[model samples]
Target chain A: MSILDSIRTALRAIAANRLRSGLTALGLVIGVASVIVLIAVGQGAQQGVQERIRGLGSDLIFVKPAAQTDRSTGARGAQGGGITLTAADADAITEAKIPGVVGIAPQLSFNAQAIAQSQNLGVTIIGTTPSYADVRDARVAQGAFIGADDIDRRSLTIVLGSAVAASLFPDGDAIGQQVRIALGPQGFNFRVLGVMEPRGGTGEQDNYAFIPVSSLSARFQFLRNPRGDISVNQINIRTAPGAKQEPIETAITDVLAQRHQVVTPDFTVQSQNDLVGAAAEVSRTLSILLGSIAGISLIVGGIGTMNIMLVSVTERTREIGIRRAVGARGTDVMRQFVTEAIVLSLVGGLIGTGIGVGVAMGIDGRDISGTAMQTAIQTWSIVLAFGVALLVGLISGSYPAFRAARLDPILALRSE
Target chain B: MIHLENVEKVYRTEAGEVRALDGVSLDVQAGEFIAIMGSSGSGKSTMMNIIGLLDDPTAGTYTLDGADVSKLDDDTRSKLRGRLFGFVFQSYNLVPRMTAVEQVELPLLYQRGTNRRAMALEALDRVGLADRASHQPNQLSGGQQQRVAIARSLVVHPNVILADEPTGALDTRTSEEVMGIFGNLAREQRITVVVVTHESNIADFTNRTVRMRDGLIISDERRLQVIPSSASSPDASIPVSEVGS
Candidate 1:
């Protein structure tokens, strides 16, 4: 028979047992859907994480104090007793004159209570210079932010985080307004100079207030030891365009080491670029793990297809015999059955892809807490899932198809 | 033409070897209508199967249309079967779901590279079942079903038609109608027809008869020619021995 005739015959045979064929196809659909959905979700999560990392300037680097050892035990550093990064270290970075050095902001953060009207909201207070706005891409929604004068003269000025401003001044403007902020054992009032634009919280820096570094050090007193010198908790550095980051980071490390008089590399200087790289690696691993789990369902679907095909062969033994007697070659019979299997799987793969894409879109549209993860259905995932499904169909269908083809005509004709 | 030389067919059962056709030799010429008569287990069916190329002989040099069919492989045997023989069975063996036209079309389909529908229609017309072509096997009478089977066999224009108890499951009147169709095909079309029947009455429909006993031909005889005018006249003399028997 011609290819068209064989296809028609195979379709007719499958149509004869509609319920069985549908059930077998359903198995493949579920299998392919599982793989598609899992991989899509994994890809979405990875994309979301990378987006968050990108949102925080890819070239930005963070430096934190490393562990300090106790002289008696000589084991490891005290968990909270590390030396602070002072403004002198920030100035030392300027002296090195490294190219691609955009901005450096010395930061000190502490939990404090801000009282406006009769309401009191506890929030973290971040103290940094004017350069923080450009480096962090922070924009003021209402009024102007703290400038170099505020950091130089220790002006009592602050900028409210979008969420914090909303809570403290429910119905009024926060700009040019004074809010009393009680820090630790002492309380002080600072004028709110600006209200930040709404940025949905990302990472660990949500619900905080920003103030001038000099104002924070002078008023809080705990921000400085008895040395009457400015102290910083951490330093944030933004790199310039087209400049290699590793060399600049090394220069920063050397500058901080000489200023702090620490012999060993006692601080952690991490590049945001490296963090992004690490996050991508983690996402990739997660996607593979999820894809494997989805692959299991595909395998189960394949087995189901094989099992159903085997049963079909047994059920249609007499039919096969009749066709054989009518001069159908063994290879022809094999081709017919295998084609049916592939059709089933391909249909399943298509349906699963639709369902998976719908699910990814649904999840992406919903509003949730923390970093908002984005989902994007990759074309390769679709191709891979469908290809795997087709392959599974062929692998699963071969044995039963071969068995049907090899049946003796006489014995099959006699089969009940 | 069909020729069998020292044909032997052995069946290997758990009990032991049983010879179905023990050194049987026979020759059938083209256009001859022959009936094979034997009791059950006398190997008449085995001989029919071997003749139809449905089973191979254990040891034989069987020639059909000048080719040694007994030595051919399965595929070659199948091809030759399609080209050389058409079959009718006691059960009709019409694919139950198929319409009469489809049943007739089957043989032509195996012949390949032919317009199956035209051949099938012509075959159905030859069997006088052109109008009943669309009716499935279940809708047709026993005689009509047998006619469809005959059409199926004749559609491919094979060298011979092989009938294995063609009327074994039909009523006496239906059997007569089926046998009449076979007689017309052999007489008018001059196509060879071989039938297997144990009934002596069934053997009378053929031009020649061969009776088997103990896997061997006990008697082979040609019937007396019928005068057409006497066959149609009421004053035709009936043989006294046949009437008394």
Candidate 2:
């Protein structure tokens, strides 16, 4: 039979039994829809993580002090005490002769409480050089960030996080206002200079304040040795644009290794590329896992299709016999039944795709706190799901179609 | 022309094998109107089903138009059935929801590349049912449904029409009208008509009658004269006296 005739016959048969066909197609619809929605969510999460990583400059490298080797256990940082980096290390890096080296900053962090108009808020305070903002890719929304003059003069000026500024000064100006910083036994007053833009807030780095390194060292003398020995907590390095990050990272690692004498590769050296790559790997695995789970539904839907097709074959035995007696070949009967099954599954798949996309979009539009869950519907996933549905239809419908084709016309006609 | 040479059909059941048609042989010439008469359980229906290609013989050879039909495959048999023969059943077997024209057009659908509507109308006109072309089977009388079945059988222009008790459900008056249509088809179209019936009076309408008993042909005879119509009967003048009794 021609394709048009097969379609007409399939449509007529389906129309003759509308309720059964609809129920059978429902399984496939749900399966395909879930696959699309779940994968979309997974894709959205993956893209969000990638974007966050990219927002932190891809060539930015973070170097932390290596754990100290114990004299007894020979294990590095066995009890959480490690070798400390110093300001001299930062100077060595600034003075290092290396191409693609743009800017470097030494950092020290402390937890402190600040009092403004009898309202006290506990916040993390970061002490760094004036170049910290440039290396970290941080932008100031109001007023100006810390300048070299503040560091030189040892000025008591601070930059506020967006959240901290909003909390301390609800309706008034935060810049040029005095805020009292209370430590163990001493309290110093500092003026707010600027407010940082809102980066991602779920991390410890986003809810901190920035202050001049010289002022922090001078005020908190207990945190350093009396001989002016400063212990640097971390070093942030930014590479030149369009420069290969691996070579620059290796060059920095060599410099740090020579200065710290850490020949065992113990120090932790990480870049934005490494973090993004790890996140992408995790996202890919998650996508596959979700896809497989949804694929189970498709299999169940396929089984439903097969079961219904077998029932249809039995129900239409007389009709099959009549058509065969009228000159329909076994191949033609097989094609007709299989066509009906595929049509049902394909229609279900399309409906499911539409529903899945709509649901994903709805979720993306909602207000979720903290970690933003983003969903992007990929074209490849839709095509893959549709193709799988067609395959399921073909595989599920084959057995029943073949059975219908092989029926003995004489015996079938004799069937009441 | 059709010939059956010692055709044997045995059906296996839970009790035992039942020989439906045991070594039955017969010959039928073209344009001959014949009736196979038998009582119940005489294998007459089995013979009709085999002749209609609805079943196959277990053994022996059957030929139609000198071609061996017993050896043909299911597809070839279906093609032969469409081209060489048409069937009518005792129940009229007009699709219940179909109109008379659609009922008659059914058989022609099996014949490849035929102008179905024209042939259906021509056949309906031949059976004198053209006026009721749009009437459903239930709307028509028993005789009219039988006439529609006859028209369905004739629409394909088959060389032979096999009808199993075509007038079995009709009254005596309606049966005669249905028999008149068959007689006209056989006479005007020169098509062979074979019928199976238990009613001896119905057999009188055919040109030849073959009687069967215990799955075998017992007697075969040809009627030399056609029966006259009831309008011309001598009882037509005296019908008023019999109506009171």
Candidate 3:
């Protein structure tokens, strides 16, 4: 038979059992839909993390304490322990005049309970210099940030993060208001100077209360390190425009090693690229894992389709014999069965894509944790899913079609 | 024209080997209406299968027209069958979903041709079934369904028509009606017709009869021809063309 005639024959056979054909296609539909939805969610999560990391500025570097690895005992200290980073290190790095040195901001923070006139809440209290706002690309939405005069005078003044302001005074203004912070039995009252611009959907950076470093050091002497100097937790560094990062990182490592009187540095420095790369690696692994899990369902669906096709071939043995008698070759019979299988999968795949895309669009919003959980479906994923479905149809239909083709025409004709 | 020389067909089963056609030879000329008559297990069906090219003879030279078709490939044999022979079964074997016209269009679908609709309609007209062309098999009577099958056979314009127990599923009246159609096809259209049956009355409509016993033909005879009554009826009004195919 001609190819068109074979297709027509296949369509007629499928139309004869509409309900059975629909049920057979259900497995494939679920398989393809799950694959699309899972990949979309995985890619969206990966992109969100990468975008947040990029918001930290491309030329930025972070320096923090590294845990000590003991050679003799073969045991490791707690993470971010061993050596303490202090404001003196920040000053010394600034004094060395490194080639790509631009600006440096040192900060120390601890969780504390804040008390207002009628509200009480747990908040992160940060002690940093005025240069922090510029270094971290933070903008003051109202009033002003901690100034240099306030630091020199050791003034008890504070700036609130957007979230902190919203919770402390839900119905009124927060600037010029007074709030008391208690850290380790030491209570201090500070004036709220300003509120930071809202950074919605950011996990941690959107909810901190900032104070000048000199004021926190004077009021809270317990913060002094074992070496008898006020210590800072981390240092944020920025590079000059068009400057290479490798040379600058090497220079910082050398300067810190010499100042600390150690052959190896006590701190770890991570560039923005390294951070983004790590995050991207995690997202890629998650995407692959989810895609493979969904692929298993598609395979199971294909197997179900094959089972139905075999039953169909057996049920139509007499029809096959008739076609054979009327001049149909073995290949003609095989083609008709294969075409039926392909049509089943192709139709199911299309319907699945529609459902997947609709579900993805329905849940396109950030979750309660302020991390976006929305899906982003790529064009290539849709195409790949559809192509894989077609391939599955062809593979699963082969054995049954081959069996039908090999039946003896004489015996087939004798079948009722 | 058809010729079979010492044809042998042996079938192997778990019980043993059984020879269905053991060195049977026969000849059928163009425009000849013949009946292959035999009792149960007399190899009449096997002979029909071999003559229809649906099975291969183990030791034989079967020639159709001028070509030796005994050793032809399966696809080539199928092509020749489609072009030169038509078949009708006892069950009528019409596809359940197809209408009468679609059933007739099936054989021509395998060949390179145009005007398929017109040809299918013309074949249905020849069987006096042009008005019932839109009816499915379930909607037609047993005799009408068999006439549809005959129309399908005629659509291919084959040189020979092979019918296996064509009237075995019909009543006395329907069987006579089917036999009359076959008679008109042989005499008026000059097409060869071969029928396989065990009934003596069914065999009387044909011009020749070959009787088989065990696995071989024991008698071959040419009886006096009896013109079917349908040829004289008013319903046999199919147009006669001046050109012959």
Candidate 4:
């Protein structure tokens, strides 16, 4: 018989048992949909990490002292093992004139309470140089940030982060207003200089108040270490536009090691690109792991298709006899059953792709457990899913089709 | 023309070898209407299967239209069967989901260079079921279903029609109606017709009857064609040579 005639015959048979066919296809639909959704979610998470890294500037790097333990209670470096990084070290790194180095800011933070009028709130007081704004991607929304003159004169001028400014001055502006900040047993009044633009994410910089390192050193004597050194907890570095951070990182590490006179310096220097690359790699692995787990279901769906096809062959023994009696070849019978399987999977694949994409889009940009998830359904993933469905159909249908083709016409005819 | 010489079929089951056909020889000419009469296990069906090319004889020489087809392969035998013979079964063997027209068009699918739909319709018309072309097997009566099977056999324009108990499941009136269509095809269209049955009354309608018992032909005789008049009224009466009754 002609191939088209065989396909038409198979279609008629499939239509005869519509509910069974739909149920068989449902397994494949769920299989492909799960694969698509998981991959999209994984890809979205990777993209989210990249965007966050871009927001912090790609060429930026952070240097932190290994001895600086205990984040909430400020640097406990002296108790841990004695302080290593200081304001002088930060100056030496900048004055060494490292290539690709655009700016550097030394940072020291302490938890304190700010009282404005009758309103009192606890906040982290971040002491840094004027270069902190550029290095940390912090933009001043209201007034100016702490300038060089503010540091040189050891002025009591401060910049408020968006959240801190919102909480302390809920009714009006906090610029040029006096606020008393108590550090340990001493209280000092500082004037607000500017309010920073909101940076949305889970970062310590988002809930802090910015001040000059010189002001913190001169005004807060209790912030010093036991060895009388002004210990800086972290140092932020910015590279020039289009500059490579790898070579600069190596150079900075070499300079710090040489200046410290220690063979194994107790600090860590990490570029923003390194962080982004690591996160992306982790997400790609997760995507494959999840996709493969869902792929098992697709195979199970194929098995279901095979099982149904075998049942169909058994049920249609007399029909097979009829076709053979009508002079249909063995190949014709085989083609008919195989074509039916492919059609079933093709239809199921299409439906699954639609549902998967719809679900992915519905959950895009939604927050799940404090992390805003982003889902992106790629075209290649859909194509791959559809291809897998077709393959599964062919593989699963082969045995049944072979069995149908090999049926003895005489015996089949004799069967009721 | 069909010829079988010393045809023997031995089926090997777990019980042992059962000789279904033993040294049976038969010949049929074109345009001949013949009946093979035998009880169950009398080898009439085995002989029919051998002649129909659906089974290979253990020892035999079968020639159809000047070609030896007994030793042909599965694919070649299928092709030869499509071109040379049409089959009708006692159960009517109509595919459940297909309409009468589609069932009739089935054999034509295996034969190349044929106008399928038009030929199928014409075949249905010839069986006197032109109005029921769209009816499924379930919707048709037993007699109508047999007619559809007859139409399917006729659509391929084969040289011979091989029927196995064609009216075994039908009432006496329906059986007569089905036999009327076969009589018309053999006489008017010059087609050879073979029917295997255990009923003597059913054998009476054919021009010849061959009775089998225990895998051997016990008797073969010629008879006058007894075409029922009222059921096949639309077909013009054809000349039949009267022989020994």
Candidate 5:
């Protein structure tokens, strides 16, 4: 029989028992769909992170404590260690006059509830210099930022993010207003100096309340390092326009290392490209993990296909015998059964691909709770899913087809 | 013409060797209608299997039309079977979901023959089933199903039609009806018909009866007339050899 004839015959046979065929195909359909959907999710997450990093502004670098790897004991210290960087380090970097350095903003933030009379909302209270507005690409929408005088005087002054400003005082004018920021049982009132412009970037830029680092050390006495300097959690560094970030980061690292009397700096500098690359690496691993997990289901679906084919071959023993009796060659019988299996998987694969693409598109740009889910349906994923399904069908069908083809005509005919 | 020379078939068992057919020789001419008769395990089935090319004999040669068919390869054997033999079974053996026309087209389908639907219809018409061509097996009665099977056998234009207890599952009326079709096929179409059965009454419908006992044929003789004569029976006055094959 030709391939077409075999397919027709297989279709008829499958149609004779519709429920079983549908059930058999369902496994593969689910298998392919999940693989595509999950990989799209991973891709979306990666893109989301990269976009947020870019949103923080281009040509930027941030500093944190380096993870310390001890050679003798072979033990390592976790990153962002205690007092990794302080006001002293920032002062030393600024004094070093590192070329291409545009601005520096050292920050230490604490999560606190902000109470503007009756209206209260939980927000992070950030302690940073006035240059934070320029270095991090933040701008004032209503009033001025925390000026140099505010830091020198250690004044209780606050800058509200657009979202926080709107939440605290919905009546428009939030400037020069008094708001109490409470850390645990202690609360302090600050004059709102400015409201930041609406800059969407992973929700952080819109939610934080900015304060001077010196005021934070005075308000929370325990924030000072053992060396009697204000502790800084992170320091934001901006580079000159059209300048490379690598040299500035290297210079800062050198200055910090020398001041700390160490061969390598106690802090680590991460540039924009480094952060994007890191996010991509993490996301790629997630995609592969999700893909393989989905692949296991595909394999299971393949096994399910084999199971259905074997049952079909057994159930149609007499039918095989009848065909053999009528002059069907063994190869014809083999081809017919194998074709049946392939058709089952092929149908399932097509359906799964359709549903997968549909689900991915359906979930794309949709708001889940509060966050919008982003998805990118990849062409390779669809192609790979379909190709694997056909291959699975071919592999799973061979054994059963062989069994059918090798049956003795007399015995097969005799079977009920 | 068909020929067999001292054919022997032995099946090995875990306990010992059991001879199913031993030194049996039989010849069936073209256009001849014959019956092979014996009790169960009497070697009649084994001989029929050998003659139908479904089994190989332990020793001896079987010739069909002029070729030594016993040593043929599977593909050639399948081709020869498609071209030369048709099978009718006790239970009809019609695929359950296929229409009568499609069932008839089965033999030609394996041969990859063209104009299959038209040829299948013509074959069905031969057994007066052309009107019921699209009816599945479940939609037809047992006798009609058997007739459809006969049409399937005829669609290939086989040189020989072999039936293994073809009427084993049919009633008296359907059995006679089927046997009549076989008789008409042999005498009128000049096609060979071989039926295997233990029933002496079924044997009366054929031209010759060969009885087997313990792996050996003890009797081979001619039946003078087709019994239960009806208007559709072949003309009794004509000699079997006078019919052109």
Candidate 6:
């Protein structure tokens, strides 16, 4: 006498109940696929942050006013620490000619409405030297950037960011056009100098306008300090390629501290590498959150699998008895039932993988929520998801399989 | 050959203990065709189950081919049952949606053998069901379904065939047809055959009849055979003690 292998018997049994089996596997398919898709999105957000940071320019140090924690008057102390760095401080750092300092650019910034033709949009107005373009990697894609003569003459010339250019001048001929930079009803007109090259990602860099600091002081007289110095927002220092940011940052800080004549400097210095590290830490946390939520769905899918298996056992009670009558042992019956369950989950896992991969590929470069969506598919995620599916099959299927094996042959044989 | 020594079977229920079989002892040599006759609740089916090794006697020793099988483990007993006995039931007990050959392949499916399909076909041929090998139980007549079940029993080449109410579901003609197959199996294959039934006419087909009542064997009678075979000198009457405690 010869019997088909346990797996074959299980396949036949599953085939016999095609609708039920298919429905049972549907839960697993959705669970696994959602896991892959959601993780891809989360990882994509992380990748987006890392890419934006890398695009922020390398070997650079940022000097900004420190947020002071004053127990006496906390909120007003924050206002006091604001705008401590000025254009004169930037001039001091540059004139010092500290070794390895490639370029120096200080910025005075404000959010205002920029209007051209019939179009007007809220944009960040950045007042800085022509060196701001070089130190910040803001390449000119059109005619030219703000010239040194523009800073000396305090000319009302503007270099539009990629997004601002596209918005203010749909004709793409903004090199000689006039755009109105306004603070409410009071406004000033500036000539368009050039459009900066397009930077990917929906970041502030691509939505800003650059102008001369002298022009900023000329237009807004109230912004000048008592010493007639132009107060700047932040200073960006670019170092030579492959140069360390620490020594360059210390030199710039010392120069500024001497210029300000303060014992404890009222500024904080941060490197680009520091920001990148913080972004990575954030991504790790996001991945864990995404992974656990998906895992719960998979467990729910496993419970669905167990439910059907138990029902199948009860439905086939007489079949079990018939097998026993024909000399099948308890283990043999258990093996057959367990094989069916594993087949269900593994098959579901395989299909889920295919669908997940296909979906991740399909939406990689899609634009969702005004930003390009990027997906990074990790191979380990696929392997781990499939492994968990196999485990779920074994755990959930165990009780039902043992129950089938332990059925009383006499009673089972008598069941209709 | 099969032996049961003073077997007693008790079933525990919520109400009380019910003794299905009380001090019943019986023996049959190889290749004997015997019938167990009794009314409902007379324990004929219980005796068949014990003899077929599908169940154990509550308080007795059941020896099969000189082995004390009462103490055998479940797996070991299952293997012995597959190797030693072929079972047929009144309902045919064929797995649904399976063809005749597939049903015949059931018993052999538990054993390790080759040419399973050919062997199944051969068993079908024994029951004159070779032409119906691919027909499912639902597609066949009641008599044909029973024949297919008989073929399933024969596929494993078992030494003994124990049938419980094998023809209870059949018409008179089909009953005769099914019993004829059992008789031929006993005579031609030299297999020991036992059938449990309540009908006296059904018992007439067997060479010996064991009449049971109230969980006791009332009489054991041997019929005079037209074609004499076996040890003709047999016990005329086997006494069974009263069932009461």
Return whichever of 2 and 4 wins on DockQ.
4
Model 6, range A1-416, lDDT digits (tens) per residue? 22346777778778888999998888788778767876887788788888888888887888888766667766545533577888888888889999999899999888999999999989999999999988998899998999999999999999999999999888778899999998855689999999989887656688989999889888876667777788888888898998877788888888888877888888877888888889989987998898889889889999999999999999899888878888988888888888889999988899888888888878899987886778888787888888888888878888999999999877778788
Compared with the true structure, all predictions reach lDDT values of 0.79, 0.79, 0.84, 0.85, 0.87, 0.84
lDDT of 2 at A132: 88
Write down the lDDT that model 1 would get: 0.79
Best model per TM-score: 3
Q: Write the per-residue lDDT of candidate 4 for residues A243-308, one digit (tens) a residue.
A: 998888888888888888878777778888888888889988988887897799889889999999
Model 1, A325: alpha-carbon shift in Å?
1.7
Model 3: lDDT equals 0.84
User: Candidate 1 chain B: worst 10 consecutive residues by lDDT?
Assistant: B227-236
Interface Cα RMSD in Å, per prediction: 2.6, 3.4, 1.1, 1.0, 0.9, 1.7
lDDT of 2 at A168: 86
lDDT (Cα, 0-100) at B210 in candidate 3: 97
Q: lDDT score, residue A201, model 2?
A: 35
Clashing pairs in 5: none
Q: Which residue pairs in model 6 clash with each other?
A: A1-B108
Kindly give the stretch of ten consecutive residues in candidate 2 chain B with the minimal lDDT sum: B236-245
The CA lDDT at A193 in model 4 is 98
- lDDT by residue (tens digit), candidate 5, A179-222: 99888767899999999999886777799999989998888766
Poorest stretch of ten by lDDT in candidate 3 chain A: A363-372
Q: How would you encode candidate 3's per-residue C-alpha lDDT over B132-216 as one tens digit per residue? A: 9999999999989999999999999989999999999998777877878888788878889999998877776777889998889
Better of 2 and 4 by lDDT: 4
